[model samples]
Target: MSRLIYMGFKLLEPYEGKLSRTVLRGESGSNPADLPDKAIASPLMANYILYLYKTMRKFWGEPIVVTQELGDILGNAVIKDSILASSDTICLLDQSKFRGNYEQVAKLLALNEVEQRKIFTINGLDNKAGRGKFKEVYIKRGNIGEVYGVEVSLFQYLTFTTEKPEKTAVESYVARFGSYSAGLEAFVSDLRSSRLGLADFIMQVNAE
Candidate 1:
């Protein structure tokens, strides 16, 4: 998906679709670290990418690059020289998995010790006593960055959750209420009134 943007963005430029955002998500599966190297080494790709951002910016477009393979991306020429330079805001999930090579990430992103600490502290704070199961994200803009906890409502989480049992619980509500949206509304309302934890409420639904 990410690599195709260099090839496809120009094709869409003439039509001028009303797309406000462009997302380039890297392949997160097991693969060689040099995969992006192969993608960016093409002179054709480099030339296409040079003009890609101009067209996107013309329509107030924001390009977001999502990659779990930071090792591959940081080492790749296109990301280091092109994408990173154009990107002003960077949102990072937990970097614990990359602690061994975090120095490269810091150097590439120009993060100092304090900002680096914020990246490491993603989901590390001991503040989840009452909050729902959530994750923390580190968003850095220019220089300073802060870690923010991300909590979602039962409806929101359940709507997108891929777990079969959990999805079945949500679907049961959708079945009873006639529509997914209204079912989500009713599900949240019932969960709120019951005062049960989300898992417990799901268990109750499963039991029924």
Candidate 2:
């Protein structure tokens, strides 16, 4: 058997390029002093999830978990305890799709009648006019829970969307400027100048 070991600085480099030292070295100013607070968050880093969750809490940092399906947590032993138990705040989007099997979810999250009502009320409110399309979310911290409407601008929508075509178009522009933030700024400027809606702009890009 042969071995390829990357020790020392080689371990700090990203797969293709140099890792950003700002977040890794606490140079971002928002991070803790002289501590690698970011630690390059990745799905593959679940090996140390429990440790990360415990230590981060001790340092006044939060560890968040996001999943499309509740089964991802309820079905797993490690996550069912480590992540779910340690999470103090819970955020939920529209969960009407899980109405049939929601009792388990309710029990798991320890939701009371008020909290359960709040969860079902997500995206069920009468929003004001000219506010653009948006969805509501339920956020529960401690014992109380509240539903808040989430409405973002066009640029923010593109930035946050998970659709393949939209992401592809966004990345195409990102590649041009060699910086995601700068590229996204340029994309928004050009999109506005084109005077087309987001759907129309996406269709035009996909066609070309």
User: Which is the leading candidate under TM-score?
Assistant: 1
TM-score of 2: 0.56
lDDT per residue, candidate 2, 50-99, as tens digits? Answer: 55456556655545656665656677666676778778888899998887
What is the C-alpha lDDT profile of model 1 across 1-208, one tens digit per residue?
5656444444545423323223123212211112243444444554454455555545455545556676546656766687677887888988888888778788888899888877888888798888887889998888888899888876678888998888998899999999999988998899899999888988999999
Off by over 4 Å in 1: 1-47, 54-61
Q: What range of 10 consecutive residues in model 1 has the weakest lDDT sum? A: 26-35
Candidate 2: C-alpha RMSD to true structure equals 8.2
Per-candidate Cα lDDT values, in order, are 0.69, 0.66
Give TM-scores for every candidate, taking all chains together and pairing residue i with residue i.
0.72, 0.56
